[model samples]
Target: GHFRDNREIAEIMADVQSTLLDLREIKSNDKEIMYLSDQVQNANTLFLQCINKLNALPKPADEGTMFVGSMLDGFFGNFLGSYHRGLDAEAKQNALNVELQSAIAAVDQLEAALLLLPKVAEKYSATLSDSTGRIVVDFNESWGYSGPNDWLVLQNRGETLKDCTILVQLTGASGKVRKNVHFLETWPSNSSMWGRYQSGEEVLGRTVEKTTVTQVQELDITIYSPQFATQIQYVYQGAEKDKDIAQICKDLSFQGAYQPYESGVIWDTQRGAQITLNGVSYIPKCRVDVAFRKGEQSKGWHWNHDSWMKGETKSFNTPKGGLTFDPDRVDFEVSFPNTNYKYKSTLTVDLKSGK
Candidate 1:
């Protein structure tokens, strides 16, 4: 009976191993699982054979309580039966560990591949039109333009737009509507597009470089040619920290409206903006309010803080630090002209099925 009981237990362990095939299907990192699965099946077979040997023992020995194997040969003995199922169990658990480790390794490999690409464009073949009042260059719907800096993306976009003349379009007060200002010429194939943007204060024939694109809105990149409808991505140009809006405004301290942004009473600048609390913490499940204000510490927070459902805040805890882009808090929801451009706009960040 002891041997039979052990055999049943071994069979149960085998079933657990069989389920590993399904585990392997869901996760490729189940090498250990596969190994343990094979081991358990083998152990079950061995244990079954042992059970049969004990089952075949003489019945006279089984009848004896202690030692009275009568005139006939008899054997009622303690079993070295297949009672040890623990070894196989430990191996099965180890398999799960191997599976999980492999999963994490695979994710790391993918991230490495993405990180190895060219960070910025090597060169550019930009052509501006002279007929237009102001040649406003907007990279609409481009990849790598998710946010501001680090915007130069190479998408392999746009139809083969021909008959494009090359020139420089200077922006003016009328939201790029004035074609009065222009710089004539084409940037050759080997032209330095990146160097031009990063070189902050280079004298272009004494035509100072004022508009260093510190932030990128979006990228609408295209590789125009015979491969017209191919996969060309937009690479929005990025500006350095010194050129970033909040920092630039700090340096300039200029007051007034800039083109493209309708500056009002307060110049909705991001200077002195900060996040109060961040990091991994248990946020209580309740009516959470996210507020932003345009005043000192003693002053109250901005009105009408955005509220998120209790379920919404749960996922935020799983990230590395429970936050992203917390330090560089710059969102151009409203335009800041200056202290004189007093256009106060408070922006808040949170998780929602929102825009």
Candidate 2:
């Protein structure tokens, strides 16, 4: 009788949605973000505690948490425990098994999808905080994974952030291969989180344009532009998992599935270092499509960076004639998964500072 009611649950749910709504609006100093963030967290905690309490309640002494056993044997014949009357426990166990397995599968399938959305947001709308002088990204534009193949997009228009470089790393969760990509192509190897420019020397003037993955353990990205420099990391997996949940809705509510099942990085490099590029290489700047596997391969996604999924398709085409940095601004977008909901805003970055 003292249990919390559905009305209370509804109130908490409203609080969550309301807080998230506020999270979408922006004020110059992230004051809205910080305040709304706390409200959202609190609402989520309250909702979860209430839900857990209800789910864990002992169903009157008769209904037992083991109610499923009774309902099961009473309806469907039990082959394993034909003589036992405790079939109730078995049914409850079966239901719980299905639920837990689904949750874990969701994590396996959607982890990459969710992880990529933030990167897409940061990649485009990343901002440089004047207070700390460090480029900052918060997990606001998260992803919803629906499948293994979908559109990914990130276009930033942050006007007040600029003057640094960019770096990116891709790796497998198995700790087997490490991949790295640098935007500046300079700034020396393994530099600190913040950049240090030489006297009167442009950070972009240094050599070494090749992007290499050190091992399968860490996949990371660092960007250095005029006054903008930051890096991001995510865990990758060697094992294949179901990817049907990464679907995103379009303009007319039509759904689209986005999968980054295959993890890698792309960049514009100097001509001399071009030979190092492999595994479905495409010169987006030059429109040159090079099939590293010579146009004959299968399951090639698993192949190491040097040799992608052997026996798989490594075919792709690029645009003609190299890509030139706009100096004013840049954008990167990721495929989105088809997920149905009222929220349909995508990320956009505008370089307001250094542009």
Candidate 3:
């Protein structure tokens, strides 16, 4: 009877269960997939803990003593199947949350891979060397991307590699070069090819010995990671479209900056200073100036040294930028145009360096 009469506890249990189940539909706002995954696991543990506490509650003491007591006890014991379905609801909620989290992670990864596709394509360039019967195949870098549903497709216009038989050589990261042959005689439009290579697993098993070519675009090659494009351009100038791809990746992957410091030469009271701003994306053109004054002057401190204020560094940390730097008995100030950070330091005479 007492258990059946506890309306507040019953309502609280119902609310928690509802909330736990609702997590399945709510999307995670966290940007990091791994962090969100950990959060879901912890939430599941908490849900189980709450359910166990409710399940541990004792039933009415003297339920079998009276008819009304026995009936009420049965009703209380089976209230929303609380006692019968131990951990089942919580388990289902956890599974649902996990499934949702996995889906979110998969989508995020695929989007990232898609964003990098253009850059990867730019690195696939081909050109003919002056040497007779030899084609120079150059690669900016070799990269790989993987997902659940992964496959490579090569799209070519019937004219890109028409009737060109040439040896394909791939230079790996360790400078080991592997060679293969690609013969394009009357290439078809929108066809596929699979082949086996004698060296470098990166190019082998991608196409058959003889397959028709599919002309989709001027140069549309959708290759899986670890595989690269080896077609050549018939022009004279070196490829420059994807030249900044490597730098872009570095800029994107930068996590944070380190402690900023000033460096340069310090002789007696005269100091020549430069800020070697230490950061993951530090560029040489960034504007970093050291302002200092001798003794106390009304004009205040003056700009002593400034780095690439008009060059490429001006765009750094903006659409554009670290390094570590230098001084004695002087007041110093560091200024960054892109950000709202200001740094000032005082140098004593003992800190002077000749070099």
Which candidate ranks first by lDDT, i.e. highest?
A: 3
Better of 1 and 3 by lDDT: 3
In model 2, which runs have C-alpha deviations exceeding 4 angstroms? Answer: 1-23, 27-54, 57-89, 105-113, 123-217, 222-229, 232-355
lDDT by residue (tens digit), candidate 1, 1-355: 0012223333433433443344345344545544544553454445344344333433222222211111110001111211111223445434433432332233233223212111111112233223122212323211111222121212112222321212112222233311111111222322222211111222212212122233333232222121121122223323322133333233221111111112257643222233222222212112212222222222121212232222222111112322222221122221322111222333442213111
Cα lDDT of model 2 by residue, 1-355, tens digit: 1112123433434533442343344232464445434544553454344335434633333332332111111000010100111234555444444433332233223222222323323433445333233333221111222211111111233333332233344343344332222122123222333211111111112211112222223335555343444455533222111121121223212111111112237744221101222222221111212221111321111111333221233322223223222122111112222222222222122224321
lDDT tens readout by residue for model 3, 293-346: 334431123443343221122111111011112222344454433223334555
lDDT of 1: 0.25
The CA lDDT at 184 in model 3 is: 33
Cα lDDT, all candidates: 0.25, 0.27, 0.29
lDDT measured at residue 46 in model 3 versus the true structure, 0 to 100: 47
Query: Looking at candidate 1, what is the lDDT of residue 138?
Result: 29
In what order do the candidates fall by lDDT, top score first? 3, 2, 1
